[model samples]
Target: MRWVFLVLIVLNALYFVWEQQQPSVHVQQLPSVLNPAGVANIEVANATNSQTKTLDSVQAKINLTLLLGGFSDPALIDSLSQRLLSLDIDVKEVVVEEVDGVDYWVYMPPLVSRSVAVRQLKELKARQIQAYLINQGDMQNGISLSMLDTMDMAKDLVQKLANLGYTAEIKEVERKQKTYWLAVNSRSERLIDESLMTELTSDFPLMRYRQEMPQ
Candidate 1:
């Protein structure tokens, strides 16, 4: 019985040795294009690139709006409108803005009426005072000293009148206004009116052209 038990133990030990000698089972790992986070990052990068390209395209494109000269002359503006129409440009309306300015006058006191103003101008001319009648507006009758920009020039004219033994007051006339600009937005930038603009520039020597964003 002891021999039998010894034989059984020897067999179990041999079986354990055989099991240890056997090859380990290997798991087959499939190749993947991207991991979970890697896949998300790649998708995000692709989306960002597409959005950037779209924004670049929009930024590169242009929609033009033009601003032209500001003129005080109605006749000149009317002429410009007609000329622009001739060029097939859809001209916008004239933007009339009244600016405060001084119209210096070399007239005697109490320029009560238009006749008085005219008579005053004549009297000043008779004295050889180089002056003209301010016509068409508020100072219509007053003898125009000079349409000077600075007060120094106006004072100089007043001094000259004083030399001629006459008093001329510098009137702060706010009625006289200036500048007419043509603002237009081209419906399509692909068809730019370069020739028309050139023609306009040629016509008005003082005309200013400015390009801005679409209105």
Candidate 2:
């Protein structure tokens, strides 16, 4: 009777150990993808071929080029790079170049245009569209300002130039280091007077002015 009881206790202990070693039935949680409402369900299967299968599907990598503009803060670059790396996507290469008067960071990924780059940039909490001017010669002869306070001020400056029949165009508006740079266009001969420029500047203290001369 004593031997039978000992044998039963040993069998129960072995059964408990085997149960602990079995695969868990509880599902493993995964990180959320692009969509918040969607949840992914994973199923594992053993195959005769001993190849490892990943839980998440590999997405097509995007190619993007980042233009940093006049903003030359090293902290900004590191922050941006780290944020990009944190995403599920892979960064191929980041090239820093200075073309004409502006600083640029060119990223070569599998992405097509700046719009796509901006979308990815939005994920990192920076949402601004940056453009590279191809013709550097056009930007040579000018005094450029560095920041703008409001869109209304930008519109006002453009309107004032238009009123003078100078045909000014606002190419782009960018904010850098708490200042705004407004890219403007007008005929090369029609020079902006100091008084008018001063008026525009006073009204929009934060505005930086730059001319994008016609090519």
Candidate 3:
């Protein structure tokens, strides 16, 4: 009876080994740990990475201020700002500053003879163009076509004079000048160029970014 029990035990062991080695006997796959706890940890890690990227992007952006110059009149500054605003620069970003500086003027040719000057004034009157007579001192024979409050006005006046068969030009002088400034907050300094602000102010050759434009 003991021998028979031993033989049966050996047979059971052999059967178990054969089953494990058989190609058809596949191992059962276990379920993955995708419970609320695991998902929560994944979400936390994603959130952390997103926050880090935001901080790095913020740090990369810089704030700069540009000072637009070459304007002696507030009208010119206003015009420039309006043009910039049309180019998508916010109106709030533009500001006018009054500072001590020199101004320019547009003047017609000085008549060599007083009689010719008077006759020219009469012609201008007939054409409905209002002009000032330089009725004093060495410039007495000169005709003041326009007093420049802005370069645009000066140019326009000159063009008007040209249309009327009169030659005109701008004259540089001295007085208080108005300046325009633009404050920019951007991811790149190149954004200013991309915004087309530079092209708009190109006529104002002196326009530039100030060392202390932050104020």
The candidate maximizing TM-score is 1
What tens digits encode model 3's per-residue C-alpha lDDT throughout 149-176? Answer: 6777788888888988998779876565
Cα-based RMSD of the predictions, in order?
A: 12.6, 27.5, 18.6
Model 3: how far residue 131 lies from native, Å: 0.7
lDDT of 3: 0.68
Selected candidate, larger lDDT, 2 vs 3:
3
Q: What's the TM-score of each model vs. the native? A: 0.40, 0.21, 0.35
Q: Which stretches of candidate 2 lie over 4 Å from their true place?
A: 1-54, 57-136, 141-147, 176-215
Better of 1 and 2 by lDDT: 1
Residue 18 lDDT, candidate 1, scale 0-100: 100
Report, for every candidate in turn, its global Cα lDDT versus the true structure. 0.69, 0.38, 0.68
The TM-score obtained by model 3 is 0.35
For residues 1-215, write the lDDT of model 2, one tens digit per residue: 99999999999999999999999899888875654433222122344122343322221111112122122444444443343345322332222333333222222232344465444444323322232222224442221222235556656655654564423334443323432122222221123456645754565443333323222
User: In lDDT terms, which candidate is top?
Assistant: 1
Best to worst by TM-score, what's the order?
Answer: 1, 3, 2
Decoy 1 TM-score against native:
0.40
How well does candidate 2 score on lDDT at residue 48?
19
